[model samples]
Target chain A: MLNELKNLISKEILLEWRQKYSFGGILLYVVSTVFVCFLSFKKIVDVPTWNALFWIIILFASVSAVAKSFIQESRGRLLYYYTIASPQSIILSKIIYNSFLVCFLSVLSLGVYSVMIGNPVQNLSMFFLTIILGSLGLSSVLTLVSAIASKAANNLTLMSVLSFPVIIPLLIILIKLSKNSIDGIGWSVNYRYFISLFSLDMIVIILAFLLFPYLWRD
Target chain B: MKHWWKFVAVLFVLYAIIAGFLMDVPALPILHETIRNLYFHVTMWMAMMVLMTISLIYSIRHLSGFKNEHDIVASEAANTGLLFGFMGLVTGMIWARFTWGTWWVADPKLNGAAITILIYLAYVVLRNSIDEEQKRAKVSAVYNIFSYIMLLVFLLVLPRMTDSLHPGNGGNPAFSTYDLDNNMRMVFYPAVIGWTLLGVWMMTLKIRIKKIKLKKGL
Candidate 1:
């Protein structure tokens, strides 16, 4: 099972890299969003608000990037071929690959955003930890939801609609933890948010793992 | 055709009206006139949950096999769910305006409910855009299941996190205590049951209509 999972993950990652346009489009979207935020809040962007904007951009970028993962799989019976391997393997691979992509984009965007908004992080390590944990929850949920929504008629809109509600709890926790971390609050002050976020990610990933088999069946 | 159910539904609608009007009398200082909307809003939310649950069941059935009835059931239930969701949204907005002095606030409960409704609306739009019946059914079934799970997360899970002026928040206690007294319970419980039955009846009728159209190749 581990070998199969590894193989599927490598395949997807290679496919992603080969599709340069997809990666470029998502990166450009993130950059342009940060640029717009800079222009719009040139004079009044505070650390908290900038923190909020940073996550929102990352959230939307993750959605856009992950929504097409399954659609691409369905392009020409690729989903069928993958199922011949193992549905669990396929889903796990997709989740892992997408998590990597989302975390990278989130960090990159946060760097650009901090430069643009000029808000120095009081605790850079803690902020990065929060982002990493939050991105795991975000990417896991988005990958599961996109798999479900990819087969929908309006994949893009349906993905957004379906994912937003599932991710709201995660978002609430992320925003709280990120805000506290940015404000230099100790982990003790924001520990509940971290635990909640971690638990949510685990619950969702387990549920998705159990449910993806049903979705993969012909 | 047995029409007794319709008669019973009509009687319940009349009862709802009477309960709503009585709820408006000035004797209740705590709730006052705004309590009238509670009959509709709370009942609509209950109905939405019932319909969404039905949709989830049908999606499960659909995913298990290509049974046409399951697809029909899923779509009909989703339609009814959307109807109740809209009613819940409008009623909640009006209640917010009167009680909170705003048309809408980012109150976790209210915002979560609104976002859930939007997600389901996107489900319907997705079904409409697809031209192939089998593909549409399969895709929609998947999307419906995803959205329903998210709806549960939003409506059930997220509210526990933050403080809100809404009932059932901040350790202030939930409405099930004094807010739902015997008098309100008499009306409220029946309203919930009646609306759910009505939604199911509507969905059955819609399924029959769709079957007829399919027979005619429409």
Candidate 2:
């Protein structure tokens, strides 16, 4: 199982590497969106708005990036992959790959957003940690949802429709944790939220892992 | 015995409605006369939550057994639950407007309820988007279970994380602690049970009609 998971993940990464423009397109999306926000708001906004705007950008960007995890696959390619890999490995690989994509996009967006909109985040490290956790949570959920949507005629809009509601709880946590970071609160004050966010991510990943196999079998 | 519960539901709700209006309520500031909304507004939410749980349980059963019947039960229950959810939201809004002087508040609980409604609405959209019968059942079952867990988090867990204008969460004085006087509890408990039973009865009726349609090859 472990070997298959490793091979599947590497395959995912290799495929992503080959599709350079797709990855680049998401990065470009992040940059352009931040630029637009900068143009609209122009002046430096308060910490809460900055935090919310950052998450919203990351949320939509990750949706587009992760929606293709399964939606872009042809039936023939999926069948071929199914012949060689376990269902669990396929979902795990997609989740891990999307998590990497989201983390990278979030970091890139944060850099551009801070430069353009002015970063009000007081505790940069804590905020960065929240971004990573948010990415993990988002990718796991969107990966499963994309798989479900793919089975339903590969509808991208349906993917977003399914994901936004499921992701809102995680988004709320992410926003709150980042707000605490913006306030530069002590770690003690933030630990409860951190634990909740981490646990929520775990629950999503575990659920996807258990349920994807059912989705896998035709 | 089966139909007996339906009569009980009608009786309880009728009792609640009449007594709820006529019974004396604790003279509380702000809430004042509107305190009576506890039986109506809050009960709708309680019923919605119960029906959604029933739907979630049926989704799990569908995944396990691959039964189309289970899928119908899940979908119908969700449909009924959405009705209650919307009623809960509108009622709560009216209550909030009267008491809080705003149509909406940035309260975690309120936002959580709104998001829960969106998640379930997405479930319905997912069901409609899929054309293949068996695939639709399977895919939607997975989504139903997944989103239900997220809904639980939104409704039960998220509210406790931050301060809320709604009672019983965060620093707000929950009805359990101060309000919910003996007079109110008599009506309130029955109201919750009555609404929940009524929601379940409606779901069963929907399921039976769907079954009839299926039987007629419609």
Candidate 3:
């Protein structure tokens, strides 16, 4: 079962790479969004606000990618083929793939954002920890929502509608943590946000694992 | 045609209006005039939950292939649910503008309710987009079940992690603590029951109308 799942995940990753547009489009969207934010905020966007903006941009970019994760499979019996393997495996593979994608995109955005905004990173370790925790929460959530939304007809709009509310708590925590990190607030002061975010990630991922097989079944 | 149901509904509306005027009758201090909006906002949320619950129950039945009535019940309940959801949003917005001195804040309670409504909205959109009736019913039933779980996670579970000005947050007692005294309970409990019954009543009428239309090939 593990081997089959690994193969399935690898296949999905390779397929995504072959398509190219999915990754390229998401990267382009992230870069353009950052540019737009820079244009609008200009010099007025402070460090903390810029940090919040960075997370928001990453959040939307992650959402865009995950929302389209299953679109390519919608055309054929690709979903059926996967169901023949195992629905749980399929969900796991998608979650893993999307999580990797979101993490990568988040890092890329963070790098570009730092350069563009010229905001000083006070604590590299804490900032990286925040990104890791925050992206995990986001990827788990987007994976679950995308699994459900992909089965819907209007996948994009439905993804937004279903995901936005569910993700607000995580978004709030991420924004706070990012802001605190940018402001050089000690982790002791903002540890609650990290705990909340990690707990949310665990709870949501477990729920998704339990619930996703049902969705995959006819 | 039972006259009592409509009469009761109208009476409740009238009582709500009367209560609105008497909201500042010097007896109630904590809630004050904002309590007037409570009659509408809380009632709308109760109605929305009732309708969504009905939708969920019927979705389960539909998925299990109990009967076609389940689909009609789900659809009608969703329609009624949306009505209450919209009212909840509007009323809550008004309440916030008055109480919080702003039209909106990302308060957990308000945001959770908004997200719940959006999930249902997506459900309706999902149903409308699919042309095949059976497929639509089955897929939506699955989505409905998933959404209810998400709703619980969003509204009940997530709020505990953060500070919210809304009731039931950060050591602050929920409305049930002091706000829902016996005097308020008299009207509040009845309001919940009455609004729920009316929601179901509207749903039943809608389902019957749909059945009739189908029978007449309209």
User: For this target, which candidate reaches the highest DockQ against the unseen true structure?
Assistant: 2
TM-score of chain B of each: 0.90, 0.96, 0.88
TM-score (chain B) of candidate 2: 0.96
**Model 2 complex DockQ against the native:** 0.80
- Rank by lDDT, descending? 2, 1, 3
State TM-scores per candidate: 0.89, 0.96, 0.83
Summarize candidate 3's per-residue lDDT along A74-175 as a digit string, tens digits: 545664565468777777777777888888898888777767766666877788888887777788778877766766666787778777766776787777
Query: For each candidate, how many residue pairs have backbone atoms clashing (under 3 Å)?
Result: 0, 1, 0
Q: Label model 3 with its docking quality class.
A: acceptable
Worst 10 residues of 2 chain B by lDDT: B171-180
lDDT score for residue B180 of model 1: 45
lDDT of 3 by residue, B1-218 (tens): 77678667767766665654564422444555676566678888988888888888888787677477798888889998899889889988887787678888978888887788777777777788777766677667767776776677677766776688875687653565645465565566566666777777788789899999989988
lDDT of 2 by residue, B29-136 (tens): 778899889999999988988888888999999988989999999999999999999999999999999988999999888888888889889889989988889999
Better of 2 and 3 by TM-score: 2
Q: Rank the candidates by TM-score, best first.
A: 2, 1, 3
Question: What residue pairs are clashing in model 1?
Answer: none
- Which regions of candidate 2 fall more than 4 Å away from where they truly are? B170-173, B177-180
